[model samples]
Target: MAEPSTARTLTTEPRRTPPAPRSVGAYPLLAWTWMRAMAQYPVSLLLLTFGQAASTGLELTALFFVFGHAHQLAGFGINEALLIYGLAGVAFCLADFFMGSVERLGEHVRKGSFDTMLVRPVSPLVQLATDEFSPRRLGKVVPAVAALCYALAVLDIDWTPARILMLPVLIVSSIVICCCVWTLGASIQFFIADAREVANSVTYGGQAMTEYPLAIYGRSVVRTATFVVPLAFASWQPALFLLDRPDPTGLPEWLRYAAPGVALLMSLAATLAWRTGLRHYRSTGS
Candidate 1:
């Protein structure tokens, strides 16, 4: 009792919880900084943008020439085919512009600089993407949007309430699919070390394929593309649904509405692959 009275009570201050993790601000700020950096080289940026736009324009030109002769692909006339191509362009532009770094992940891995992203508070993926954001890539949007507008002007859709709402949703789903495909490509780097060429084959080729009717491909090819890679879900079926066109490949009509779900699943798969790859990654000393 005497000893207890003699000892002064020691009070410990309650620990304050760390401030809530902030993800919302990090990416926007990082993206702004990166955009500023791109602004430093006005002419070079202009040239890079022009180059991208020109290349994509040539792609659309090729499609025009093909349709000019064939006049139709599967059941898709030039107007409908152009609709698919235009939406696909918009989808690819959104993905490539926002997440251009997905292709160069191997280089980052080789340099071991990707490790730096792991120590940050925000998501490594978001950080990587924002760090690599290219403002110049937005130039491609001009041609893509132009194509989409041309399609809209030419095609006569039912344009019901659901279709109106689905337009933005379709656009978003397209972006998600394209981005996930790019992420999948980056994930492959963990296994192959340098698979940019392979990844490009899938993403760029898949993108090109999406611009046309899948019915044009062989049966086996269409089956693989639908069930395996599923790139067709990005824009083709959505275009069919939004424009009230029929699917010549005989997929269920309801499948058109499944674009958002497919996009989510692909995104989850890509994320899982990225985490798996991250665990397997061996940092190079350089």
Candidate 2:
């Protein structure tokens, strides 16, 4: 999936980078520094924030128009579909906001800043993950939370104890899965350049998949989203549980409860992939 056109020239020989720093404080400091840097530019902040929300809004608007004609999608009313969109948006936006720095790994690798990360006494992964935390991204979160709240108000699902408990878990698990997707993509930067398209296709495209009910998708798509890629764990499975809907796949009713576990597994897998990629690094010789 890595395109050579965007890849930087480097030796094929691989070697290990430096060990991580033990200082825990470097992480908070790095995150705070990134926040302050963003604060210096209010206009950029506004644009970035509004731009993300606008993209999600456009998709929602198109869905609205579709509903205006047909009144439902895969048996979901507009508000029900909005619920899926909102939950997915919150999860995706939170990942983009919190772990956005992962997106910059390619640039760091190309510019040799990744070496700087190695020289530091802190963990390179943590440093890179926190390097770009834009508080303005929370602006996008506002509308998403609003949509979710609207869904909760309008959807006829009963809030059982499990549902109430899983609500927060859903948001948390979605965030983790999205970050793992970003980390996996960023890891590709260690092996090749401009993995952005591949990463976006998986991460953002996965979110796009989540914006709709999974009931309409075919068996292959559902399996890919479940066992292979696990997008369903982030949105669809949880939605089914919360909404009291049955799994069309007939896999297992308990699958909905496994969101957090799925996220955890993905995070572990991503970390392993990143570490593997790091070991293969033949630096740019900068």
Candidate 3:
């Protein structure tokens, strides 16, 4: 009793609240996440990068050899051909680097992971795409851009402000075109549940188309690619503007300037197709 009376009351401190989590921008965060995750596998990263460089270099060499024996193909000379090819390579590399995982959307949807995405606060498409950023694909980009720069220097084409501006237009337009083709490919998963090879036909096949002048292919094939898929707008058409070649398709000179526009249209169509496919997605029972 005497001890309790003598004791002074102790003051207690209140607990501090934790800080709120910081929100991150989608693109930068996605890129960082990809870089960090990819860095974890140093050996695999190096192998992919070097492998892409070698394969592309070899392919270009073959094209050089072919054109060395012949004057030109479809009005483009060897050096001009390389310039176009290199530009396409850069476009492909950049597209594949960022949007490569679009190829895997089928599997994600089939596995019900797409459903999991619907519950998140972030935009499903953006989050899913960000989660899949692949720097390993940059393996192709480094050499492709390097080759493009080299090709530009070696080639005799006159440089104009308009031509210089076309470079970025070509890259962004190609990305949109590829994304559209990929969405079309992904839509098959809704019906077949597994149509990877067929989808790849567009992804890989589209990339293949970029390696040559559109005129090398038969008129029928070119028409199908241009009107049906609009792949030609990404590389072939804009290329005409850069090379100062006349449009044999009777398409106006301004049409080449519409590469980004065509790409946007294709992308919208692909999105509509995707929405149609999503409604058709039948998730397996848990």
Off by over 4 Å in 3: 1-24, 249-251
The order by descending TM-score is 1, 2, 3
TM-score of each: 0.90, 0.87, 0.83
lDDT ranking from best to worst? Answer: 1, 2, 3
Off by over 4 Å in 2: 1-25
Summarize candidate 2's per-residue lDDT along 71-148 as a digit string, tens digits.
877777888888887888888878887776787888888888888888777778888878777777777677777888
lDDT against the true structure, per candidate, is 0.83, 0.82, 0.74
Backbone clash count, each prediction separately: 0, 2, 0
On TM-score, the candidate that comes out on top is 1
Candidate 1 lDDT over residue span 1-286, tens digit each:
3587657876799989888768778878999988889889889888998988888888889988998899877878887887888888888888988776778888877777788877788877777778757777887777778888898887887888998899889889989988999999988998898899999998889988888888889677766777788788767788889767667777778888888898989989999999999899888866
Residue range with the least summed lDDT across 10 consecutive positions in model 2: 18-27
Q: Which prediction has more favorable TM-score, 1 or 2?
A: 1
RMSD of each: 7.5, 10.4, 6.6
**lDDT computed for candidate 3:** 0.74
Top candidate, metric lDDT: 1
